[model samples]
Target: MMFMMFSPYSFLFFSTYMLFMFSLFNITNFYYYWSVMELMMLLFMGLSYTLFVSSYSQLMVYFLIQTLSSFMLLVFYIYNLPSLLTMAFLMKLSMFPFFMWYINLIYKFPNFMLWLASTLHKLPPMLMIKLFSLELNTNILWLSIVLTVLFSGVMMLMVLDLRLLLVLSSIGNNSWFLLSQMVNMFVFLFFLVIYSFSLFFLLNSFKGMSKPSLVSSMSSNPYALTLWVLSISGMPPFPVFFGKMLVILSLLMTVDMNYFFMLFLVMNSLMVMGYLQSVMKYFIYIYSSNIHYMLKY
Candidate 1:
């Protein structure tokens, strides 16, 4: 039913992503972990769809579901109405200030579970935010956007572990998706697909190498490494580049595009580019040496 509800292109994209996950991690080794996370994600998505269906108004659906979930947890007894819903949504996304759990999960969980947590698990909450955002305050939205971008960018720069770097990158990408919601839904979906594909190949590269200290040193296949770097950086010619271009063009068309917002976008783009430059430079260093010399370091 959910498959039918999604547009054909989106449905195909989701199906392909699932297939990539299954193929990347042989099912037998991670069967139990995969099944549990899949069930939880399904339940979350199901409830979101139910809410969307039950109420004609998107805002009312968000309010009612958020309230009901809170009541179930006895939150209604302790918190005011607005706080209840606010806390629920923040918890749902594991957003700023409440994001410690999310970071810990990424740092501790096995690759299979971390994949779900950092990617597919974000979909339901993000979908609800997109649907119910019609009347969301623009000022508050922009504030959250700025915080998300800044926080994620800082974490990405600070993280040394390759997996942790990917986790922070995923968070930044999620923020970009949220920003895309304000611009264009089609572009958002396209961006999601590109990110998923890039992540899949990047993770594949990680599996082939043992060292987690240096991503370029660890990537045995330079071609795959280059593709992953280019795609994530949203460099020209990649599908991600087109997706990002559409988002930027859409944002430019918006009447509310202020200098501050434009400056933020430029900074975010530069941050991503800086990371990619370092990755590529390291890859060049590795490639310049003999295999033994590269591996020794």
Candidate 2:
């Protein structure tokens, strides 16, 4: 009876979730990891369009890009081409030059897909990075991280939309993902967990908003909004703070990470600025709107 009530989309969502979990067990197996991620992307595209009919074309293009990347990834891995393999994963993760689709499509994601894409979908390629010990040019890596951080910060300053802020913040966090892996797989996993936990609450809060829109204003729960800001900015008292500390410590212990360390501090300041902008706008909204109610009647 319960199965009978399950929509096709729900079933597919569960299947994708199971496949994601199953892939974790086979995380070290290139073939299994590749196959599972390929399958997951296929399911993800289908469900995304099914649920968000208006964004079908965008979803299809994103699908094709990922499919092509997956195939190229296979060929590169087989040839022991670490450079190509690393590039393939970067494209798959939609970092920098390849990020146009991610920015266009993330706004259209149903909240579940948003969380899945932001957190889980990103994991396998990162896992593969560790599995194969692939490395990119240090200059290229530094440049990419710097660009993502700078872009997200600048964009965040202008956006009032909650979902857009979440997207930009996650884009910036991809730098952390890339850097954490350089530290070690364990630190990488720790960072991912901290990120996922913080993002989940942010998403859940937005999900609770009614049909007109997911407003980030104090019109909703203002207290929750403050927590959301802290979560994104990684202020003290949140595990995000500690996760970043450990990454910084690990990077310091590694040679030649001084530049990255300096860049990391700049990135953190930008994150705080961006998220604080979000919360402050809400306070501004409340004060301006509420200061005159019924005009002393």
Candidate 3:
């Protein structure tokens, strides 16, 4: 589950990507013309993953097959080269600088497609990040994580739009990849899966709401929705709580820079508080409105 050194990580991602994409539409709504663009995006992304992985594997094998001296020399040269490949994969994942495009795209897509993009489309890029992060410089990685988490958290608090909030949340959640590096793969994957489920449940509950809907109308299933929100907020008893606990424990052991870890904790607390406030605001909206007004919308 960690790096999967012996397995073909590429094929696994390719398969998961296909399954998630296919699962988004049932027979009733599986129209070809309606989702032509999305289908094309999936096809292109899948093929790109296959090619990149295959080429990388071939290159590594070629290097390994060479004499030891030649292999070490090649490694030295490669190490000195710029990390363009890594940057490209991160761009595809919509991390940081590349993320604004994704934020804009989510608004144009339907909720179901949004779920697929937010969860499934993220698989290969995540695997690539995990694989590369092991070899990349730790200092650079830590700096990127700190910047992304703080910036995304602040932006999330400022947004009133539901879609933007979700997008920022996804970006903030992406920090779990960095956390995974500190602890173990299980913790990272646990957070990823639980967060995906939270998003899926939340989006599904928004079925009858308007575009740019207020957070107050997120769901009629208030209990379920609240649980999902709290879980994502890293509230206890949820898997996210365990994941964060593991990350914090690992961070304490492996890194001496406790202040950075403290920053992460503070930012997470603020993010969760903002989410609860939004939910409470929704409840107030419900109480203040008439039954006719609620039914009319």
Candidate 4:
């Protein structure tokens, strides 16, 4: 593979340059858009190397490149490009539905790389709020929010893997919550930190278990996974809960309460019940005589 032939640093440099060229050539007319595209492209290219390249020495370079590119993009948005800024903003945010690339990357990359992806890529959406005038169209914002929430919720429900579910649910809830604008900004940040930390811990904790245990824990046990899923789904007390609370608060303030509230409650409750049933089945497995057979090699 080309990845194995070149040193990570060399490969990263080459990739970055290539991406720069692609963006430059494509956006000849739209110079501002081209620049933003190139910057994001560079960050994405760097992310690929950071994840795939085996060399630890290249880590700092990769991070530095990503950070600098991101900073430049942010400054450009804040200053020069107000018209297509929101599009650039959405691209940067990597929010749900608009997030297929990110989710695919997460699935392909190792867990540790999630740190860089989550931290660096999360800024664009947050910064978008600052660029918007108070009079910006609420309908488009709400539509995006609703779609993100529903799609994420359904995807989480369907996904057999907890990590994937968590990823989807987090994106969904956070996108909707951000749209609501009811919660203080600090609360959203705090929730994100806590949720991310918890996911890291949960994933690491199950590392010692056998393959079957891991699979069953993810697939068969409703009771065992209940807390984990609920926490991720923003049920209550968990950090995501605050995000959902803010979203709900926003909906109450702006939209028709009856329909939105019903939709929110019903969807969330279904997710909760789905995880609950799975957890309950897992616990029931503990008491079954076939448990030994299930655990046996």
Give per-model TM-scores: 0.64, 0.86, 0.65, 0.58
Q: What TM-score does candidate 1 get on C-alpha atoms?
A: 0.64
- Which tens-of-lDDT digit does each residue in 198-226 have in candidate 2? 77677666633111135533236778767
Q: Tell me the spans in candidate 3 whose CA falls farther than 4 Å from its real position.
A: 1-41, 44-89, 132-134, 208-217, 255-258, 291-297
Local accuracy of candidate 4 as per-residue lDDT tens digits, 145-221: 56666766676667665556545655665455354443455555555566566555444344321111234544343
**Candidate 1 weakest lDDT stretch, 10 residues:** 47-56
Candidate 4 backbone clash number: 7
**Worst ten in a row by lDDT for model 4:** 206-215
Q: Using TM-score as the measure, what is the rank order of every candidate, best first?
A: 2, 3, 1, 4
Please write out the lDDT profile of model 1 over residues 22-81, one tens digit for every residue.
Answer: 442233332343343344444434433332322334434433444444343244323434
lDDT values for all models = 0.56, 0.73, 0.56, 0.51
Clashes of each: 0, 0, 1, 7
Q: State residue 65's C-alpha deviation in candidate 4, in Å.
A: 17
User: How well does candidate 1 score on lDDT at residue 285?
Assistant: 70
Question: Which has the better lDDT: candidate 3, or candidate 4?
Answer: 3
Candidate 4: clashing pairs of residues: 221-278, 221-279, 222-278, 222-279, 222-280, 223-279, 223-280
Error of 1 at 204 (Å): 1.6
